[model samples]
Target: MSGHSKWHNIQKTKGAADAKRSAAFTKIAKEIIVAVKQGGSGDPANNSRLATVIAKAKAANMPNDNIKRTIDKALGAGNTDNYESVTYEGYGPCGVAVIVEALTDNRQRTAPEIRHYFDKFGKGMGAQGCVSWSFDRKGVIVISNEDEELDEDTVMMDALDSGAEDFSADGPVFEITTDPDAFNDVVAALEKKGYTFESAELEMVPQNYVTMTGEDDVKNMEKLLDMLDDNEDVQNVWHNWQQD
Candidate 1:
């Protein structure tokens, strides 16, 4: 696995123990709202974006009732909150490229708050596309090996047959990659075969990674990520920091 992929796995492990469950739920809820509005439907059957978000929520162990409630609320007449997708690019400590994806009702407030973290914990915020050009958007599906029931070769073949571009094992997880447009289709194919994911989402994959070893740089990078993760508007954060 690549360094960023490893770092992603580490963060997933840490997130479970992190005292940000409520914040996580809030972020997922906002995602549901955005997916519904953007896809022009609240039903996952017709909304691929919403289905992807629902899958992500389930991977996070979000309760079924909570997920249903979120969808119902989004479809309800009383829910009128409008969110727009926004992305910010920047360099974090030790010059690690960072990308943040957010859904916000107020970019005026969200932009400044994000810039504050970049200024405090990173070098500073960069202009749009400054760092984004160095990344490619890809569909990523993560499957856990905790159950010990998965056969590596079988899984690999299944993923390949289902439209995955690449597959690799990272310790206890299998990371599957696909073209962004084929993400939902591959995910659905896997689901039909009774496979579940640890996490699945479209993510920014860095073309090149930056490795940070200095103590201060690593600390600052962690702090910056935590701050971004805690922000409800912030849905996903990607970086090229190769942890050592």
Candidate 2:
């Protein structure tokens, strides 16, 4: 129901700049591997989960060749990656709720590294369900309208008709939210009408937001996020920190 925060903005700007393209694509490829194995198909047409992940890859501007290669590799013989989905719930400075979602082959190595990050901020990590209670898992789709060429009313109507739960416009960006189960269906519905996306993926939407007023608190929070982002195993990080 609002603009995605500073962490999101940082990722967008960096993604657009290709500053972390290789690393980002590597993480996404892991998602592809899991999606293919779990969904039991390499073809996105028949696999809703794979379709959603492919939409995410497209939004990230991952190359078509890379995507195809990853899918092929996933379906190939002797592919031996077994990634377990793990979620870490924690608090940052000023009681900011943070959740880190990861896919790791080895829990032992990934667990200690994640714990180290939280411990850096005074044992910030907590039990799995601790902070997730305050968030809703939602499918969010974003569209860029920087030139104001996309009409708000038309877009809103289209999104609503396509089964979006909510629509919000901030400056030149439009966000459409949907139920996680209906995410791929909504995306496909919109795409059929020639709508392109800036980002389309499931996310942990925080129910409330809090600001970090102290300088040290903000610095620690930023560092914590950076450390997580640097890890190849970590996929998504969600937080309630209100950032500009």
Candidate 3:
């Protein structure tokens, strides 16, 4: 887990979605709609993609009513607009590889906006597979270390037995990565063992990390990331930025 991952955990601890956290809720809603449409099933029990989105929504403390509404919209759709899942690969300041995953009704609108963000920061968007080649998609589960009294070995055993691919310890938290196809089963097993985690979702992890040393470049990179985060169409952003 990295600081960005830790930040998400901390946000949950702070109850960041207390009716006033519109931004997070909006993102989760979009994901739910897209997942439902793509999965071809509004039922979370049968659809792993929908289940993952629901898991993320639950982790964010999003209201149950809101989640249900989004699912309904996806299922009872008389609309013609279909949200196309797209991944745009680019680099940020200091040559930090960036990947933006979006669900859009129009690629015509999203392409140039994503490109503009890179250009504004003096970076150019790369071809579709350029930066994505450096990353692998995996299911990430984050667990807390408060009063649970679990060590790296214990966590590893639990995750590995449930078909988890890897585990990493970052400070007080443990990161669990599983095969994308086996994510739901692994989560269910961990839950059966009374392992309550902070969040579980599919994520893009870089094969190698890039460290930014200078303060100025770090600030610029932060700015670029913030800009991407502010975009409603952008569902998730992954990067190789490792602070030194």
Candidate 4:
């Protein structure tokens, strides 16, 4: 099992219902657009990437109407957004590895902005594969068990039977890990068994966590992540920072 609890970082966004929620919706919408364009289909049944993005959108509490409208817009002839997926990897304060995933139409504008955030908050951005070597790309599905209504052992076995690579009880959630290629299958299999996910997405999971010893380092890290989260181009940020 992973040493760090998957749900710890999710706690950071518990109270966000204003600008953050809107920003999340916008990011997910952009992701839907890109997924539809790249996958060549508006229907999730035929488009695995779009299905993954839709699951992510639903996890973020994005409305079903918003999702339908975004998919319809993506299918429209007048829609001309040509956003490409870009990933930025570097180190945050206290040598914590950081990865930022963005969907942007302009690489020129998004690259420097990410670099600036790193420069202002931690060590300057590094070349690709610098910090990424420390992480594994996996499909992570988190199911809420807050009320203890779900049985952990049963869920774990079910996940494993459904082709999940690993399973763990992360506090109030059941975390299931699957290979990136088999992610959609595992998610669909679990869904068929009447499981609902609190979050389901492909993520760069750190192999180990780094704890910040300095107060200044902690503040800088928090600021850096906040800036990344608020940026419209940035869709997801992954880090090795152990959240308290």
Candidate 5:
């Protein structure tokens, strides 16, 4: 299975509330608010970032009403939640490279809390560019295989024609990769062709993966990931751990 699909399935199997769906909603809402503020528009047509966040919200199963409300609130007068983007790079257990992306109003608290996780469960935190140099940012789109009418050949051809950089069919989904600049155009083209995605987002793709064989190392790595994911300030966690 592809790495993206493996992580996706693992998340799905973690069950609903235990997986912290509510926290997921909050994270996506923060993303919408930030996108609106940065892009200076609520309409997706004018704001490409907002459009991307909207797609992510939909993929997370966030309700349309909730999304609209958040956007409206974000555009309202006197909104004070000005979140700044922060990224932290570190090494998880067994030398696995991990990157965390967060949007926070309080960097002082967020930074310390994140560093604590690394200190407690990893090989200690690193400088800003330490582990990030090993990763490349890419646009990933996932389409489910549940649709009987969906043709793999047709989808692959359409994806490439739509400006996708690469395409793969692994397990239950089709993974389409695109250059970051061409992401929106590719997504728009796929949408016009009536393709609904399981998920779509920009992610850091690791060039090399770490293999963890020690039981203690694997346990600590899981703990580290859980701590990061459960944090309210954290938006996304990217790692290079190769799951067996």
Candidate 6:
């Protein structure tokens, strides 16, 4: 979870930079478009994926108009271009493993571009299952435990009751995981209990982590991961690089 926290920090720093705001919006919009398509409905109330993405976009202070426009495009019958969700697995500099989840209208165009980025960074993409075996699909939800609103034990008990598989502390928040089908119920239960979180979304958790001992190696690895994250087709990037 520390590695995930560090990665989130890096993304936050990059997103805050003035030069990256446009890029951030593009990425967020793409996610909304894809989420609407995947969820099969434009209304967030009926579409869990769209609801989660809307929450994330709202957190970033993205304009409501922009969000509505994107959703309308997704629902519009005139739209023809179709995007497919794909995951790419690979190892980064210093041998850190990575998984890149993308939503692209053209895999033919996206695959080559993604491969090139890795090749240029002295890292190479792996076959379908090469690095995927290291990760397990899980529902990850982040919730605030501030104001002593929910003690750890109380939260843990409720989470387990709601079908959560595991729980951990990620910085000042709790990271809860559950079976994919149980995600909605777990989150709803937590919310009903008055826990307000910064963010909640599904994620891939690595079964094992590759630790970097040398500072130089860690720096290089970070640069490579950052480059992978900037791709337009990419939605989320996951890795197993423990960070303190």
The number of clashing residue pairs in model 4 is 0
Poorest lDDT segment (10 consecutive residues) of candidate 2: 5-14
What TM-score, computed on C-alpha atoms, does each candidate reach? 0.93, 0.93, 0.86, 0.94, 0.92, 0.80
Candidate that would win on TM-score: 4
Ranking by lDDT: 4, 5, 2, 1, 3, 6
lDDT of 5 at 191: 89
lDDT of 2 by residue, 80-108 (tens): 98899999988888888889999998999
lDDT of 6 by residue, 113-166 (tens): 878866766368888888878788777776665555567778778778877888
Q: What local distance difference test score does each model get?
A: 0.84, 0.85, 0.79, 0.87, 0.86, 0.73
* Residue 136, candidate 5: C-alpha displacement in angstroms: 0.7
Among the numbered candidates, top lDDT falls to: 4
lDDT of 1 by residue, 1-244 (tens): 2323743535642564246667787888899988887888978889999988988887778889999888888888898889999999998987889999999889999999999999999999999999999888888888999777899899999999999988888777788998988998999899999998877888888888788878898888889988888788888888877765
Span of 10 residues, lowest total lDDT, candidate 1: 1-10
What ranking emerges by TM-score with the best candidate at the front? 4, 2, 1, 5, 3, 6
Residue-pair clash count for candidate 3: 0
Q: List candidate 5 stretches off by more than 4 Å.
A: 1-18, 146-149
Off by over 4 Å in 2: 1-18
Clashes of 2: 0
Clashing pairs in 1: none
lDDT (Cα, tens digit) per residue for candidate 3, span 1-244 = 2324433323422353343368878888888887888888989888888998887787666889999988998888584546888899888878889889998888999989989988887378999898998888888888888665997788888988998887777777788888889988888899899887777888887888777788887777777776777777888888877664
